[model samples]
Target chain A: MGEVKHILLAKFKDDVSQEQIDLLIKGYANLVNHVEPMKSFRWGKDVSVENLHQGFTHVFESSFETTEGIATYISHPAHVEFADSFLAQLDKVLVVDYKPTAVEP
Target chain B: MGEVKHILLAKFKDDVSQEQIDLLIKGYANLVNHVEPMKSFRWGKDVSVENLHQGFTHVFESSFETTEGIATYISHPAHVEFADSFLAQLDKVLVVDYKPTAVEP
Candidate 1:
């Protein structure tokens, strides 16, 4: 019931354009204004030099104060709209969540 | 130049036991004590009810105050020891790092 961190990893479809990817990134950042329970959100392209990435190239992370806050953020209309539109452009996606007892301030 | 978040998504080899996973998780947390630049580390197994996870089932996230801090953490002996020993038990691993303009306290 404490703070929960949500991490999302995605690989865009091979044919997706750079412009579309830019839009999606901007769209996600804008959600902070609309989703009240979303305490923070940060995202970026993979920058690891390690050859271990496989095909995933992007990661987005957000934190919520509670489990219900996460549920609310997931079902929020803005989030749903963005996901509905972006899913087709993504070849793969991975979602993981956890409640951390120790977090950086 | 700012806060960087590193997220790793991985799937263990089918035969790996839960005990090993628990050990790896504890090992990462211990790095925060041994590695000076690793500001925080939090990890957990996948808990999403969504079907989008594919074959990945675990994630670990850590934050560093700068790019150099990240490099230090990656090359730290404790991190290297853990990664070297566990690489054989992992089927897939994805590493992503980004500098966030905004982060939750």
Candidate 2:
């Protein structure tokens, strides 16, 4: 299997309710409900943890079959609409992109 | 255990070597060799994938026992030094801190 092409790890604005968070989770997934070229996807809020991993609020990991696939997703109206709706509520944003070299199994 | 107060999730500079990534992973954990009131920490680089997670670079999750504990960690020299060393290499940084309301089993 090929490595995922893009990953968007994010955190919502403080004071956000679980209900709102859940809505966002589903909304993003629903946007590109069945776009091809994507291989994997997942979203999560920061969970209660015992140690070392306490501060993170949410993480959304998605993978594409190729860079072209990612570009398509970015331009797709559904994806754009989702981004516009979800990101509008965020305060701090950090986005990073990478192409993996080696695979660990 | 108290919920960790601070969380610093990050991605390193693109083209960063695996060796460098490993150094960062161990370094952060080593910095607080044995601090109290803090509970968690973990680091990882973007991994190869087949679909949605293709472009992201790396993620580091760190949590503290209390807001104060995190504040202390931030001011602590060892932690400071470690942060200085590692953050110096990061290009894009996304830090988020959240207190859990409902614990999930």
Which CAPRI level is candidate 1?
A: medium
After superposition, candidate 1 runs with Cα above 4 Å error: A103-105, B102-105
Q: How far is candidate 2 from the true structure (C-alpha RMSD, Å)?
A: 7.9
Cα displacement (Å) at residue A99, model 2: 4.0
Q: Write the per-residue lDDT of candidate 1 for residues B1-105, one digit (tens) a residue.
A: 468887777889999999987776777678889899988887767666566666778877788897788888878888899889777788988787876654323
For candidate 1, chain B by itself scores a TM value of 0.87
Using all chains and alpha carbons, the TM-scores for the candidates as numbered come to 0.82, 0.50
TM-score value, chain A, candidate 1: 0.88
DockQ class, candidate 2: incorrect
Model 1's DockQ score:
0.50
- Give the lowest summed-lDDT range of ten residues in model 1 chain B: B96-105
Q: What is the lDDT, from 0 to 100, of the residue A29 in candidate 1?
A: 75
